[model samples]
Target: MSAVEAAPRVEGRSNRGTATWMVVPALVLLIGFFALPYLTIITMSLREASTRAVYGEGFTLAHYTTALGDFYIWGILGRTLLIGATVTVISLLLGYPVAYHLAKSRSRWTSLLYIFVLSPLLVGLVVRTFAWMIILSNNGVANQALKATGLIDFPLQLMNNSLGVTIALTHVFLPFIILPLLGNLQAISPDLAMASRSLGASRMRTFWKVTLPLSMPGIQAGTILVFVLSISAYVTPAMLGGTGGRTMSVLVVQYLVDNFRWPAGAALAIIMAAVAVIFVGLYLRLTARAMRRLP
Candidate 1:
């Protein structure tokens, strides 16, 4: 065979070897960091705590039953899900347009737009939550301006409630939604859009049919990110929500810290992890199915 023919086989073998080597490190890390910890937590969740011991060594489903049996816990879970859903919808509504704008615009403007979207991440979450607290406080700038303009008879109660948590979280995670969305949008070649337009489709129709479908991966990715973060969020909800809109994470912290109930807290943590995994798996499967249908 010619050298060129031999080169293909050699290169294929090298690539396979490289991939195999790469996977060893990944497997090691996953086993040591992710898998082992997950197993430990699951084991811990199955045990109960005793007053004399840190945890009762015996296996029992009592902790799970106790945690799941509470109506208040379910209410808190429902509220968390509501917040996550609301945040996700709002993020998509807001981020999709920004992503489309960034992806379709001239390449020169992309860096500036990315910086603008991601700048908020530079600040700490506490700082951002506190800043929102000030903005929505009864005497804060937002209320003051509204009162100044006579928009309302009284200051809007934006702080210490779900509204405050939602607003802060939306701002906090906007970049996560925007970046993935922009990536998906940018990956779609402009030729597709141009070709659709050439076929006499209106801009709106072309976007609805072409751009949006192509960008579903990003939209799904951002949605998962926003939802998971919103569900597990503690700082924003704790600072802004208080008792009125407490999340599961806040309750988990309370159980662990205030009540000194490790087993219950561990059970809650396991549930949160399971929820996150399920959400991610569903998202991946949906995205994969969409991709399979595409071409």
Candidate 2:
């Protein structure tokens, strides 16, 4: 090679080496904290149960077998999945319009609107779940308001049920979807939307054809985040979910902490995680098909 060309190649090699060095620390942390812990949990899940100890001498798949074959466990798993799907759909529907408005607005209400989006995240999750408990209790604010408005003759059963858990979870995770979506919307060039209008497309039609397609990345990211969070949530479900609302997270905690069955709990957690991975994979594929190719 010529001296000039050889110099550029040597520089490129040095740059690549530097980049690899920069990435090493992150890879170490991920493997140490994230990957290793997950591997331990997977190992725990395969361990045999013992009456005298947390695990027996040899490993077995009995935990998985017992969990999957239990019809009662399957029922809770189904309910958990249903709640996750419901929360994802609701958050997307509600978050999109708010995100879109915040992205485009220049008015005085913009700051006030931004506060609403951030307010939920300001409070701690446990504290917020407690607040929901008060609001959702039989004679609490929501039921009292309903009674005052003659919407009902008596206080409705709100807390200690799936409905209450769902409502609280939706509020808690709403901000997660909006923030990602707002970023995505703001990143979109106004020119693309404007050009669509310049070609005589109406505002609504322009959004559907141009803006929405471009924002699919945000939609995909936000929905996946919300869905995963909802499924893995423990606090809200434990606080609001009575027997009827108890989810897999709550059940897993019972096994690990209350029951002291670490192997069983680990198995359940692995099952839940495996199911989440499968669903997320399929969801990504579906969303990928709809995503517009970007330059």
Q: What is the RMSD, in Å, between candidate 2 and the native fold over all Cα?
A: 1.8
- lDDT (Cα, 0-100) at 154 in candidate 1: 87
Q: Which ten residues in a row have the lowest lDDT in candidate 2?
A: 286-295
The count of backbone overlaps in candidate 2 is 0
Candidate RMSDs in Å, in order, are 3.0, 1.8
TM-score, model 1 to reference:
0.89
Instruction: Report lDDT per candidate.
Output: 0.87, 0.93
**lDDT score of model 2?**
0.93
Residue lDDT tens for model 1, 52-150: 887887888888888789888888888888888889889889989998888878888788888889987989888988888889889998999999898
The TM-score measured for candidate 2 stands at 0.95
